[model samples]
Target: MIRTGNEYRESIRDGRQIWIDGEKVKDVTTHPMFKPVVDVRARIYDLAHEEHSRKVMTYADEETGEANAIANRLPKTQQDWKDKRAAVELVQREAGGVVTRVGDETIGEMWSLYDGQDVLNEVDPRFSENIRRHIARTIKGDPFHISANTDPKGDRSKAPQDQDPDMLLHVVKETDSGIVVRGAKYETAAAYANQAFTKPTIANWGNDKLSDYAVGFVVDLGSPGLKFISRNGFAGRAPAADYPLANRVDEVESLVVFDNVEIPWEDVLFYRHTKAAAFIRSTLHRYSALPFVQRTLHLADLMIGSALWNVKQTGLEKQQAVQEKLAQLACYREGINAHLTAAIANAEASPGGLLMPNQSLLYTGRVFALSQLPAMMHTARELCGGQICITPDSATFNDPEVSPWLEKFYTINDNWVAEDRRRLLAFARDLLNSDYAGHRLTFQLFAQSPPFAQLGAVYRNFDWSGPLDLVKDAANLSEKVNGSL
Candidate 1:
């Protein structure tokens, strides 16, 4: 069931239309903007076949004895969650940076729908069966799955019918074979990914019992009439020596245009059912938030490392103030670690029998990690000092005429040479100050819906009955108030 790197590469070369920077990418595997991340994904596939990583990256199926990716397997026990976490860690370690929107982080969204099988069945028994089939296929096929939920909703106040109907992706009509959809979705990694669990971004479905906007389906990236018009990629836009993360692991976002793209009957997970859409919207990140928040933990590590190294180079690590900042960063990092660890330890059973991370802890952890990211980055930037921004590019260091002066100024000691200092500064710059950094920050902010929606998840999941009971008992509330509760 597992595919090799070459096999994964060849699968995406199915003549899918992809455009970036005003040029149509001929092959994403070789395209300059995409090649780096594509190679990272390819390397992950290859890792599952490698001797050292095989055990961590994949597990044998009980029935067929086929080695399926551990990332795609349904969680039934605590060990499965731990293994998935380890697999993600292995990937980030190998890539030397964090890359979100990759396969593992997204596949869980489908599993969320999988938990809503009863709701889907209410709309159509076939819809529930479609989700089960897809989840099974993901285990057996090893496709690089991703998510697509947000659309370029034209105006918030007006409905789709009032403005551009294509503002939100919706079914245009139904054919004998399938339904044709016309609209665009803002999806990360869509240009190079295999498929997306396309769904609605609307959390409030209002009073409509059924509408065309209430649709969810598995969209094949290579389907005819689909166009991937991506934003300008960070890779190849700057010198790698200056912005390594950007050049190495930028996951390009695309406006995937469904120009009358047809979703085959088998691919449709839900249709014309607001209840189905509402169900997905409410619980979309039930499982995926674990991995998404985990990535932020990795980002915190990068910030701490970059800042600590910078301070050490400047001989400021021993200062009490400097130590305080480092301590704050540690707290931030461990705060995330604690939430992840506890969520797994206290894992709860999903309605569909899958084990999901404790929902309240997972959601609160997401809010903490993302809500504090900007401030944390700022603190890291301050610790790194102004050198990260004012530092000259690698080219200037290589200039023979300027090299001597730069070396004299940049070199702090024998161990801290000009080149190493420049590298650290460049890394810190890319991590904290570059345009890529801003984009990544924004991605984290809205990746799991907006700030308000994240808080809403926390509100819905956090148990309030215990606190209310405690308060009522302490105050000795009247029986009327208790009855009202």
Candidate 2:
């Protein structure tokens, strides 16, 4: 059965070991820092049950013969890719491109790909049915939020084992019921959304020395011995009133501490098989990138709309320079959308029968999107100019003394009120100047890999020479006809 938003909420109301500023959170739903994020996730659950989105958000799993979230259902054909894209768009629309973090969409897609695998038999034939059942149940009920724990090493040169062992999450002991894992997963996004889907960030090969760290499994959010440390509280600031876009769908990062946490045998997906580690990472790469492009499209739409609206409000719509700037924002949005559409159109079926985006194109898009994001934000900032920074707090307009003065000085076009114009400008400021703004810019810069590393991945994966060679041949033919002028 499809779980409702309230049901999902109740499931997580107890047993979570969440901390904000050194205090253990008694209730995540009511916590100021976590509540909005929770509300956003709850809306996703509501989408699954909505009449319009119910079909798109969920499908009948052939394995379990029950309806589950599309994120959990893997695609095996072109139609499946289309269906998955539809599901992604539905969620993106609900998020307004502002309320959900991009990582939530990306990591959720990765978890779906991971669950698509039939690795149960590979781990232990005895646990195949048990694992499959768990996977199906998880897909159907849990809106799994995944945090790719890849940045444990402060220095990039050191490997996991070479670094302080505690820097990476690893197994500490094995118990009769399960294995005890002790360590922390850092820079985890949406920690409060779904705690059960935590797994290793990289692949582990089970040599005698590394076998303890070779484990992968799912645990309850409120599992014994697990703890979460959040950087900020949700209620401390309001999104619309304070840091608009970032606060709306702010992605919270936390340290997931597993202090001898027991993960039952049935919950383990990979154990002792070093080879399967490669499979997990590769699978994630294939399925994760496309959904991000989906979310980016929504973000682009928001940026473009705001930029154009601000320009019009300022009466700069008639100015050629402003028109050109707006055009650039439009072009960027269109280009990104085109890339996403082409990637989806050209997707292929994987071995598991799930359709996945072309890795090379997806990777290229990821790099390009991140590179262009700052420029897009800059366009909005430039169009709004000093107004973004000068806009008074919403409360200022509410004050009788300041209201008349603010109205006289801040009014834009006759069609718009000074307060309305100020609100939009303030929204733009929150998006481009707030602390969250800085985090987003940094996140885009380092989301996948450093620029050089990303370029290397694109170069390694795509056949640049082949395309370049074709263009060269065409140029040579044209030169001969033109007498090398």
- Candidate 1 lDDT at 413 equals 99
Summarize candidate 1's per-residue lDDT along 370-430 as a digit string, tens digits: 9899999999999999988899999989999999999999999999999999999999999
What residue runs in model 1 are displaced by over 4 Å at the alpha carbon? 203-205, 483-485
Clashes of 1: 0
* Cα lDDT of model 2 by residue, 1-485, tens digit: 76677876786777767788778888877776766667777787788788888898878777667777776665566666677778777776776544334223544434443454566466666444554566556566555455444525444456567767766667777788877787876644545655444455653343543355555666665677867777874346654664555555666777777777888877766666554454454455556667666666777777777787887777789999998988988888877777777777887656555566776787788777878988888887888787677667878777998899999888855799886787787767766777777776776676544677666656666756666567768766554342221
Model 2 spans with C-alpha error above 4 angstroms: 60-67, 99-134, 154-163, 187-190, 199-211, 447-453, 468-485
For all candidates, the clash counts are 0, 12
Global local distance difference test of model 2:
0.66
RMSD of each predicted structure: 1.2, 5.1
